[model samples]
Target chain A: MQQTKQRLLTGNKALAEAIRLEMERDPNVFVMGEDVGVYGGIFGATEGLFQKFGPERVIDTPISETAFIGAAIGAAAEGMRPIVELMFVDFFGVCMDQIYNHMAKIPYMSGGRVKLPMVLMTAVGGGYSDAAQHSQTLYATFAHLPGMKVVAPSTPYDLKGMMISAIRDDNPVVFMFHKTLQGLGWMDQLDASIGHVPEEAYTVPLGKANIVREGTDITIVGIQMTVHQALEAAKRLEQQGIQAEVIDLRSLVPLDKETIIQSVKKTHRLLVVDEDYLSYGMTAEIAAIAAEHCLYDLEAPVKRIAVPDVPIPYSRPLEQFVLPNADKIFREAIQLVNE
Target chain B: MAISKDHLLWMYETMYKIRCYEDKMAEAYAEGKSPVFNIGAGPVPGEMHLATGQEPAAAGMCVHLKKEDTVTAPHRPHHHAIAKGVDLNRMTAEIFGKATGLGKGKGGHMHLFDPDVKFSCGGIVGAGIPHALGAALAAKKRGTDWVAVAFIGEGAANQGAFHESLNMAALWKLPLIVVIENNQYGISVPKTASTAVPSNDVRAAAYGIKGYYVKDNDPIDMYNVSKEAVERARTGQGPSIIEIETYRYLGHFQGDPEVYRDKNEVTLLRQKDPIIRLRNYLLNECGVTEETIAQLENKATFEVDQAYAFARESDYPKPEEALEDVFV
Candidate 1:
């Protein structure tokens, strides 16, 4: 295999690059959805794909979510691995019946008779002024589905690795990508870190949570943009001699419980930060699971720093007020360890 | 055109079975013997949607398909599931949320999966359309002489997936028969308002395929129309969408008041009830004696009764095993 290197780009662009790579590797792979080709995806996640792959492969579809998703299902059942993009996570209301009830459950429902190898990629999280109709951090809702693996990444490395893993995964997987990660500018740093990945086709294994920063005082769990906030918060706390271990839970459904539990056991305290609401969200679910499993190892009660339960307002200050940032996560972490 | 005596007798028999089975469910539900939220020892908290007035759609369509063929169903699916040769005892136990039911009591009324009997559930509205395509693809690939029927309602036709699935089924030359049971409603929403088009199958030319229509008041007409579509599909003529214009006589769910429509409309459609029409056909065309038909009805009723008895004797699932069958 030859070595392939590329210039630095945005996180969304990097993902678009990865999608192109996967398509190049296998003829069976196709990207289908609205505006994926000529429109270059809703946010340019699929720029330059139509010319590279053409309509037969990088096809654009009508505004029919279920039909296109269903076509993806039929294609997968007939042996093609189709990567279909649902424009926004919130548009999943009409498509939920197909994704949640059938796509997620059919493989198991058929007793392994059908292997649905499909990717339901979507743009999730907040910060964009798409209003309530466009923006809602809904990872928790899909995470509740049994047969689907929920992938939430906060960096380019995680994005590349998780996308490869998701594309290679046999079951139906929802890759929730946020608009915030493109700010990291980590694509250029890819070669500096993991070096260039092998040109030959491969897959990153599922269910492995990475410890982005290691410490011994308190364990911090963050997802997507929250991971970035946690890192900044950890840096600020390190000055005060407080070591916070950051665990990036890349996948949510087949959640890496052991990694989080083991990290908590080491730190004796835990703080969860998320962009979703405080009640019944991933933060709460993570806290509950940890409390039930690692209650005795805790020196202090687990804490969750989340956006208050409300619709994300459009104004910048109000949005900041509703979102959890470095100051909030830092304040929460310091309180848990200091108290 | 009225149904023949032979087909009319079969429809009457099927409608009788559906009625008997539903009555049994109502009794079970009333006696605290239902699944969901009650003793759940007898109550499983899951809502069950009974297919009462939708008998003609199931009976008429199933008439065209052989025992070896397939039918995909929706949430309101008990009639289709049973009509496809799924055991009543297992189905009853499922409705009661017992361990012995199909899907091991995981997918109550909406999901009645039977791979062996050629009946699988897409469960979600408009979702099963693709599974039908995939199965039809498999049948075509394996060179098997069978047609896959994707049974959906007027409401499901409004769904984008319905159009997408039909387009692909038409495009790939797959042997899939898409039967649209225009039950006039999807839950509380009426079809006339929900759908942008007057008809669903009429859009078949967009996918480069032929569309069909049937005013399915009589089971015989439904069977005949379905027969042509089934024959076309089995012969590798690609897919055909047969829109059966009918109405669901009951509430969308077990407790729907159907406040969405006028009662006068219901009364008008009921004048040509499939069961009565079939009975009339049997008397005029089949030249069969009333005693034999009565015996068949009695047998079906007895079978449904035994199914209830078997389901009642079945045990509840252990709490520890609650999460089983979620995966294969």
Candidate 2:
């Protein structure tokens, strides 16, 4: 058996390490965004990249999202794989046209003549009362739009591997990493945030789901930080008679429906947990999938535990009320398994 | 500076070709327009934003550009595409939504893209400004002298992307040229109502870049300014903004009632048409024969006819082809 060599890393550091590896591998790769150079990124996804790559490759752009993002599109069209940061997923409103129209549609519009091998990385999720503007996990919004791949990594291992894959992918990829999962020293950390990542380069593949925990009673689906919540909830459910199966949907765009369907077939009960809002989101989509394909196999109504259609409030209690947590996922999974 | 006869002849031919091509496009669009707006109802459907009288700006600016140089234009980009030496047959077929088009029928006229000549345009106003800067950045990073030109109207100068692009280009000293075709209208709203400044070139001062305003829509004057700007960019002197005062002979789109502009203004602008002025300059000043000018016009007309026929005869893309380009 091959010994698993691992080094502990935060999600941000893992992403930066992946970027460093890709930058070392290809001369055409570069990073650009607001405060990405001197400030080392608002979330440190680009920490230490400036010193390694210099200012030529690590560009500090103005707060003009439309201009710099569109510039990334143009640069990508010209054969440079630009990794641009949007700071926060909530800030996509300022430059949605560049994201949806130019960056996303350019390849399709060019009829495959031009390839936009670029990564649009941004921090997502809310945990520490960043208010409504700063704390949105909007993976669903990008996933809803065509012509772009959307991925959210929960573990340090997945972050490093998927960041590499996203940068190397020929199409545009939106890599949304949850802020709470970054394991930054300044922010409160989750046990699931820091993990053993391999030193060598690898890709986890874009559209495959990882069965982090196996059980037969019920199936639990989650992404990003919510995946960690589902795992914790699954552990708690294991103390009871219910054995919950946890599936982490790493990539939302090229979704691993086969894995989801297979898990649903075995478990016969489904519960989806998402940090994003409830309506028209990942949870609803998963429920729709179960309803469409494995309706006969389902023993109970599909349950969803997501943000209850409210903007993340500034108050801690109000914010906690709207967010999906392990307690909420556990309660919902218990009802799903028993019902 | 004295202009060479060959360059003058090339400029005239390019301008004439743009004029012929746009005129034919307008006629075809008019023929295709039905009472009800159905996207697939016409031979050339969708919004046809014709650059009827803005040919000189495209010809003057693009004549100084090489195939390796990149260009990004607004929705009204047929003139720029033709001026940049994009395949006319493919471009027209793209407008006709054919499988053999430049974009394989995925992008209609407003969203034409041709990587061969490094030309692209988007529907949103001022979106191309930053894209041009990006292309310029690519060239600079690759250690090449190839520059990029972004064309926008005076109306789009108010957009944040325009200001940001200008500032970044100047800051990075990227080889970029921004040409503002001040046709005095942004869709239906006149420039007077939309922009606070009378001259769009004056706005470039905020970015600490050189700005020029050409009073007349004369092709020779435009060519002179563009040559200097293009040379400055190629030699690494950084970016410049040039605003050309011109007029569009037709409505914003083919079916526009044009309630915004005074009727006399259109008539007066038509009297100072750049194509006619260029032809007269070639005849009276450059010592070119009338027969040569006639031959160029005839050739342009012939090419437009051939492009139209090719587009008309081309096949529509298969329905399954839409899924092909979405990823790769």
Task: State chain A's TM-score for model 2.
Answer: 0.98
lDDT: worst 10-residue window of model 2 chain B: B32-41
lDDT of 2 by residue, B256-318 (tens): 889987889778888889999989988998789999999998998899899999999999999
Q: Which candidate ranks first by TM-score, i.e. highest?
A: 2
**Per-residue lDDT value at B290 in model 2:** 92
Residue A139 Cα positional deviation in candidate 1, in Å, after optimal superposition: 2.5
TM-score of chain B of 1: 0.90
Clashing pairs in 2: none
Residue-level lDDT for A159 in candidate 2? 95
